[model samples]
Target: MKRFFLLVLCIFATSCTGGGSCAGKKEVAALPDTFIWNLYSDPKSIDPGLVQENSGSDVGVQLFEGLTEYHPETNEPVPALATSSDVSSDGLLYTFHLRQDAKWSNGDPVTAHDFEYSWKRALDPKTGSYYASYFYIIKGGQEFNEGKNTDGNSVMVKALDDVTLQVTLKHPAHYFPQMIAYPAYRPVHRKTVETFGDKWTHPEHIVSNGPYKLVSWEVQKEMVAEKNPYYWDAQNVRINRIRFLLIEERETALKKHLEGSAHYTDDIPTLKIPTLKSNPHYHDAIQLATYYYSINTKKKPFDDVRVRQALAMSIEREKITNVLQQGYPTRNLVPPGIPGYTTAKGLSFNPEKARQLLSEAGFQDPKTLKVTLSYNTNENHKLIAEMVQNMWKENLGVEAELYNQEWKSHLKNVEEGNYEVGRFTWIGDYVDPLTFLEITTTASTQNYSKWSNPVYDDLVLVQSGKERDPKKRFELLQQAEEMMLEQAPLIPLYHYGRPLLLDPRVKGFYGNLQDMHPVKFAWFEEEK
Candidate 1:
């Protein structure tokens, strides 16, 4: 992170020589072979099958091996446990040739059977995995997860031999390989799991197949991982250890980074973005993620589209972006310029129109309607909520009470529809626009909004299946996005940018659109 920061400072300095903001930066020191990173919240779960959040995923990737992985720099799907693949002409059948050399941290052979067990375990109704929907593209996957079939054999995932796996898909998805890199699809050590039961992922019992193994975990303080000596390709791994510290406040994270104890952080205090903007150590990537608030369409007031629209438009999104000084201004559910698809625009800010909509929704003066805006206990989230709270009051005369809860509780409340509206963000697991559009589908477990429309549902869930041409499929997807925007189940605020503190010596760590970088590829360059 510090290394990346210094590079940025030099680049920015060259462009801003007249102002010379970065003229006097000192040389950065090479970090020891240990990378220290920060997480906004402690991971909710580290279990490969159960972990749903990104913090868990960051650790999951280091401690588990998947059939494929995203290239560190290009973000392209490449073989990992699998050495090669062959697809049937229809693109529905994928035959993976697994690497014979792969082994778990326990020295047990990593076989095609491991992946078969893991994928089926994910699809099993008994697992209650929220992310099981990610594999719904595989034939019979949805039926298996939904309990329509008790037979795991009915699902099209099969291990043909010790080192060969086959997957039959319901449709030909161009992005399925990329999606496979997600931690939920990674193999688990079945014997360890059977022995430990639900405690299989404990630091002591977990037998991972990735480049790192869990060394220690101090709970809310930090979790440490060290290089696996037995890793199949251990020689290529540079950093020997990684520490993921859980610190909610970006200010504290920045202090840790500036003091040289921390190598990277997910976010810095927004106020610091300007000062560090020209600093070489600061980094921000426009991630494939959207920052929005979920409106519980099952709840009153929000059950009305006008009410949702009015609330969405009343808040000025630009003001929020200006304050953060990160990300592009967007009224889009799918962030604009996502490669192939046309960006769908949502309701724009017009205070008068917001007032008219509120009136139409039977709140002649919205102050009579009291709503609670719930968010996680992060300072940035609090400040943004307060700004929107004032906007609701000043623009539409609504009384919005601000509520903050810890990350885990906040997500649970949103899932249970315990709040009328709550803060949420969706980072695309893959580059596909479908990653964003599919989440709000009628049947998706991740659809916290509880907003369902037959037309929108069919565009995503049904029509999407029949469209074989890439352009036609995207067209169907755009139709779905348009319907979703019209209904306004959530407020489209702005796209995300990972405003991070990076050590200058940290090398080979790449941030893709999804903003995921495997720690195995990271190294500290020799400082001159």
Candidate 2:
């Protein structure tokens, strides 16, 4: 312990300065290696298979590694645990050559069998992982998830050897390599999970193959992770410790940032974006996420296409954009800037047309029907819901009720179709349009709206499989988007862009659409 302290002091004292701690470099460096980050709220779960939102994903990414990962800067798929891989001539089979030196935090060898066990565990109906639908591209994956096939042999995933993983896809999927980078595909140590049971996700028993390992978790207070010595690429890891503080209030997090208590934060208030933009450390990145209202298509009056379109057209999205002041003012499902694909344009703002459509949908006086807008408790979400309420009242003389639920409850209610219109946002798991479009498929478990469009389903699922040309496949997806918009089951609002106040002390920070921060390549630098 004395030697470790002396080593940290030596690096900090000599590394000398830039970013934010220039004047206090010696004092800052004399302490233990630590990076303080902010978490807006409690993560739903640390288990990779159960994580569905960005809050959980951020922590999950640090504690686990999949077959591959998004390149820090480019957001492109790159090898991580896998040393090399090969694809069959038909593009249906992928054989991954795992790195033999990889080991979990508990010193267990990370092998193909670990992946086999973890993948099958996620697909197990008992696990109830919503993202398991992501693996449907693999042969028999859907059947396994639906419990139609209990035998493991029916699944396409196989461990041919200790270091080789073979996968057979239902059809050619060019983006399959990138898709594997998502947390649902991350491997868990079979022995660790079996021994610890539900406690396996606790910091004490958690075993991971990522660059860092969980050291302590204090629930709604904070969690800490230390560098994993057993990690295959541990030599390249620079940061020694990362501390995540669970802070719900944006103002509280910002106050901590100003006091030098934190080095990174994504919880800053949207209203502060304009003021913070002048600061050098203030950062903004275009995220592949959309904040939209999930209209329950199974119920009235939202069941009618015209009624849904009317409500969508009535909302003045530009007013919301002015407050956000980051992402694009879009009524699109897919965010812009995706390579080789155009975003889906749903409906435009026109109060006159909205009223006309509302009347046409059999509601002469829209105010006669009261609808509920359910959302999680957040300052921004509450304010947006208020804005929407006013918009509906002024444009169509409609009355809408607002209900605030906790994160987990909100998700359950949305998925169960318990509300008329619910607030929802989807951050892409991968850089493909399928990440955005697939969720709206009739078959997707993440389809909160309970919307089912048979023709729309075929375009994304059936046709994309048969179309060999990538361009043609994307076009088919585009047609699907157009068809879904024409029906208007989903009311598009605005795209999401993250505004971060990052401390210069934390060097080598890379921001992308996914907003994934891999701390392995990050290090502390003296602030200039």
Query: Whose lDDT is greatest here?
Result: 1
lDDT (Cα atoms) of all candidates against the true structure: 0.82, 0.80
Candidate 2 stretches with Cα past 4 Å from truth are 1-32
- The residue-by-residue lDDT of candidate 1 on 276-371, one tens digit each, is 877666666778889998899998978999999888888899999998788777788898766778987678898899889889988886778889
Global Cα lDDT for candidate 2: 0.80
Off by over 4 Å in 1: 1-31
Each candidate: how many clashes?
A: 13, 7
Query: Model 2 over residues 421-518: C-alpha lDDT tens digits?
Result: 99988888777777888888987998877788888888888888888998888899888887877677777788878888777666666666788877
Worst 10 residues of 1 by lDDT: 1-10
